[model samples]
Target: MNDDRRVYGTDRGEDPRPQPGRVYAELVGGPLDGQLLDVTGWTPDAILDGAALITEAGAYGPGGRALYDPFPGDPSRWSWSGDTP
Candidate 1:
């Protein structure tokens, strides 16, 4: 995983300007496949608990969420687990 990767803009209408001190994780699979997640300040416990990332491209469409879990061997990577309503 490339820690240097940063999200300057997103389809969700986030600010296009680069944010300093922002940590990112590579999102693999699901609707957010190949996307970068801002995980700055996330604790190990939070990472272990995983995340339900909001995505308009999810199975339930807009307002749906895509579940992601941290890769055991890589904290900088998150693998898709499933989708939520």
Candidate 2:
């Protein structure tokens, strides 16, 4: 299995910026699928950085550009309802 860590950000090397219509990324497919990746070590803001962790694409593990998937809505709010804060 691919044990390498995945970082969420932009697929392109450009610095990440959040704006209307802008896209962000997280890992999809393979072993890391559906798991939240912690990228604070490299990217302090992680997904907010909008730059690929591995610029070469597919340079490390099984995933490359093809493995990049649109980030699903944050799961932290999944269990949150009108109840508890």
Candidate 3:
């Protein structure tokens, strides 16, 4: 479990609502770079596997990994806190 979860919010001035059937993933440097991927219906495990193929699937740090936060909030979101282990 790592406290490396990223916090997403309206700081970028974008709409805060999450698109249904998709989850946002922060893209790192590369093609489709610095963009957020709306991972369509993909679970945490699926994202990890698909990330290798999907350039849209990405993370902030070196590992290119993350998990969605179970607790939903307004204008903000968090990744799963304990999955980093």
Candidate 4:
């Protein structure tokens, strides 16, 4: 098992306990070298007693673009919100 764990937000804030809604997802294959690849995005339900799409299927980032702009590894590379990349 790759044992990959990824989450955009934490349960303490994003998802409160007691599970207020029902979630859904569609799983794609994994990455090479035994890496676990999973993409997730949620949609809120608008109606009464109706919940949002907790997880949308195929909502992952586009692949093959080689977009790897990550958080600045060096403090010098980092910039404030007011600054441009």
Candidate 5:
């Protein structure tokens, strides 16, 4: 929801660098299985600046789903493949 831009080189001729972003969430309820959370925001060039998103030992929500709502991602915004979601 915010835009932050940074320059790479000392001179203005150099290209601009983009400040990274992250989405956090808190799972209300679900299951605790061997799942790999494919965080969709990051791309090839999107460097993982500080932490690793996915982990083996994950925390839980009210029922069981991983409490990932740190960045407040809206689950309704999630889409799927095949035709479309």
Candidate 6:
């Protein structure tokens, strides 16, 4: 079995934090509030486009998606937009 315990920006090792050289985007609000998204190696355009993050704690609950957009003027943060079915 794989012992890698990396999830998002967290690691289950002795140092359970974001490692060096890895870029992360902070998720603001929504079900994934405070979570980090690994944006390492992502292009500027891709970051601007944002992402539809999957969440079980969505508005409709289970199997729903949470929409997040890049916070304008802040490339390191993603703000909650809405929820989708």
lDDT per residue (tens digit) for residues 55-80 in model 6? 77989788788988899999898999
Q: What is the per-residue lDDT of model 5 for residues 17-79, given as tens digits with 9 covering 90 to 100?
A: 332353322222223222223334754333222122232233432322222222224441221
* Candidate 2 lDDT score relative to the true structure: 0.33
| lDDT digits (tens) for residues 1-85 of candidate 1 | 3333335235576663336677777888898787678778989898788899787798989898999999998978899999999
lDDT of 5 at 78: 24
Q: Rank by lDDT, descending?
A: 6, 1, 3, 2, 5, 4
Alpha carbon lDDT at 85, candidate 3:
14
Query: What is the lDDT for 9 in model 3?
Result: 32
Poorly placed runs, candidate 3 (over 4 Å): 1-22, 52-85
Which pairs of residues clash in candidate 4, taking residues 3 or more apart in a chain or in different chains?
Answer: 43-53, 44-52, 45-51, 45-52
The ten-residue window of minimal lDDT in model 5 covers 76-85
Task: Please identify model 6 stretches exceeding 4 Å from their true place.
Answer: 1-16
In the range 1-85, model 4's lDDT, one tens digit per residue, is: 2223333223454532122233322122322111111212422222111211122222333321111111234211111111111
Question: For candidate 3, lDDT tens digit of each residue in 1-85?
Answer: 2223332333466654454455566543443333455565666655554344222234444444444432233212223432221
TM-score of each: 0.77, 0.22, 0.33, 0.16, 0.17, 0.78
lDDT of each: 0.77, 0.33, 0.41, 0.23, 0.28, 0.79
True-structure RMSD for candidate 4: 16.6
* C-alpha root-mean-square deviation, candidate 5: 14.7
Instruction: Say which candidate scores most in TM-score.
Output: 6
Residue-level error in angstroms, candidate 1, position 4: 11
Tell me, by lDDT, which candidate is best.
6
Order the candidates by TM-score, highest first — what do you get? Answer: 6, 1, 3, 2, 5, 4
